[model samples]
Target: MARIAVIGAGMGAMAAAARLAVAGHRVVVYERGETYGGAVRRFERDGFSFDTGPGLLTLPAVYRDLFVKTGKQPLEECVDLVQVDPSSRHVFPDGTEVALPNASRAGVVQALEAALGAGVGDRWGDFLVRAREAWDRTRRPLLEEPLWTDWQVLAEREPYPAVPHKRLLRTRRAGTLAEIAAWELRDPRLTALLDSHALAYGLDPRDVPASAAVLPYMEHAFGTWYVRGGIRELARAVYERCVARRVEFVFGAEVTRIVEKDGWAAGLELADGTVTEADHVVAGVDPGRLRGLTKHALDEDGDVFPDASAPSPGRFTVLLALRGAREAEAAHRTVVHTPDRGAELNWVSGEGPGPVRPTVTVLRPDDPALRPDEEHESVVLTATARPKGDWAADGSSKPFVEMMVHEAGAAIPGLRERILWQETRTPGHNGDETGAFCGGMPAPSLAGGKGYFLRPSNSTRLPGLYRVGGWSHPGGGLPHAGMSGALVAGLIVEGPGFRGSQ
Candidate 1:
């Protein structure tokens, strides 16, 4: 059996560790932090708890497969996976509100038409139909298989089949998401609806390719889910699975360098001057951290690293503990749309100080586990922001938090007065906790720009070195991170011929 050394105890690393152990490999995981789960952290105070990371899970089948492959007990047996009905509620700037039913196309269409006016629903339904095409075209190459060496083919080709449009006696096809929203949807609220999905991922919809339609499509197809306590429980389950498979974890072991011997990764050197030897190394941290550990220059065309010129974006969150019980009619998730889309986009893209009124997503779960009692409630407000700058400063996140609370007031009545206490998590805080450069959260892969959608391949130039996690192939998000682990184990155990997980 080959000896494997995995860096970081994040979900992706732990997932790979579990699978590899089941394959009879001796796997050792080294994490710089005391706990596993990476960003899947939870905060508790006065008997209240809140998930500091992703609040919801999409495509849970990914984890289901992980648990099934590793052990006899499936994912459901390990954690309470509940499907959230009425996936989300959208409160537009104009005061129009709509609660979209979970995984129900007809329900979403009917609700949109009722809130936004007649005919809007049909347009949106049509758009979803087109998005399904993009999902089918790229799902195999992007999610089910390893990134191809000739990934340029995937990049140069747009999987979204744009409908033919004729304007001023000329026929043209939409290339970017902005064009699709303007030309096909032809409604301001519809445009906001489409852009919000991309914006949540810190992507500028104006520039993002049309294939991005697949983003919302994935949610509609699979449905959104919530773990019983918080997403942290999901991480706990994966970590436990790893331990059950005999994978050893060394906490507080900061890997300072990747020891190389004969041009292959030999082992890892820790900050405390301890070295652990291994036959293979799987890195599950960000690309910048991986580069720092190896001190090796990556081949320009070989690795799918982020653009050095543009900094990645991170999340800014405000956790609220309120004095009143959650209203029975409250939607589990609500997105308060920004008044000015242009300004918000410009600010997030580094053009200017972000809009004073940024789009905000508020999550308020009904589960009693999050509250001290039925008389109290826990709420989380999240928005996308750049990872660098003064965001983490004392007063930096306060204004944004206040603005978010004001916007969320639309969903939660008497929001300002109901608050017992509030806490803020900035991108800088994320950097401190997770060790990501500038605390940036990577977005899922897309199709365009010469394989720009592809992440760094699982196999690296160093013979025994590989990468897994949100920063690597298939890119970020819970499901993608889990799939990355599966891909890495497949490559390590089954060899390069490992096409992907079945």
Candidate 2:
């Protein structure tokens, strides 16, 4: 068994630690933040609990397999999730409603037919079928398997047209969300909503990949879900699992650098200057920051995890613990668009450190336990691509906080009154706490593809180091992070003296 140190305690690190420990590795995880969960974190104030990140979860079976593979049952401990029906609501610029299926093809199509018109249903079905093929063909070979080599898994997942993925390759240097929307659907409204879905990971539909057309399909086919408690509890469940598996956790101890010995991973040193030895070190944080964390044993070839071909998009977030739930005419998840309406990057102009404005991602916490008094309510407001350092003038200025809170209330309907408590976080806040990762791109920006089969593998450049979580492997989001942890463990088990094939 390898002596391993997981350089994070978020979903990715925790998942990896649990899996590694179960496989008999001596594992310890280090987290810098006061609370764990990384992006899946939760915060409470004024008797209000807000899941600061990852408000919803889907594809739970991926997590179940992780726990089961490690010899435990996930459901027995963390949560009893209820599938969120009418997966989500899509509001068009023209003021129309399309209720996505909780997990049915016909229901969603019918909704679309009613909202977008007759032929819209057929196009959606066809689109979903193709996406299903993508998911079916790629889930195992690409997402479930370890990354021994980049293209090996890609090739396997993309064995298409009854054989070979060469045809799927797009020679275009860059593909955008807008281009793809135009290709599939005709109506500007339908196309725009399709592009807007790219915002799920903070991508502007215009710049993301056409292959990303699979997002809606997966949500509808598998279904969106809510864990019984606040979403942050999901992280707690994984952490609890890790403890059960004998994975040690060093919370609030931020890692400064990964020490190397004779050009190999030796161990890690915390910010407090404590050094621990290990045979393997997995950085469940961000790859972009990995080089800075590890003490460099100079290589003849300066190869590092060098950010993925394309990093995921990053944005700002606002979590609100409200006095009561908004009685919406739509489902829990809704994407609102404007038909040449006002407010197009207007609130943010001549603002932010990078002179950039951010989009928003609004989520209503499906958790019933978030509020203290009767009618506990939570509203997650989000959009994408904002200046990371501008919030609160490096997160210190008092004026910035007041300014942003006011802006949030104005942007959304009934936001200010219902909100009992509120908090605003920038990507930089997440990066500083979690070693400056998860700010640039969502996993889809990096992993979404025409040949998603060729996405980055879970393997790290350093010996005995693996990656998981939003910034790695199956690439961001709760469900994919679990798969990454499981797959990486499987690969580690199938080492040089492997007993079986992965």
TM-scores, all candidates, are 0.97, 0.82
Task: List model 2 lDDT by residue over 51-106, tens digit each.
Answer: 66677777887777767766647564667678877676666645665767789988
Candidate lDDT (C-alpha), each: 0.88, 0.62
- What lDDT tens digits, residue by residue, belong to model 1 across residues 93-163? 88898999999899899999998999999999999999999999999888889888888788889888757
* Model 2 local distance difference test score: 0.62
CA RMSD per model (angstroms): 1.5, 5.3
Candidate 1 has what TM-score? 0.97
Instruction: Candidate 2: list runs displaced more than 4 Å.
Output: 148-176, 295-312, 324-330, 338-361, 394-417, 445-456, 496-502
TM-score of 2: 0.82
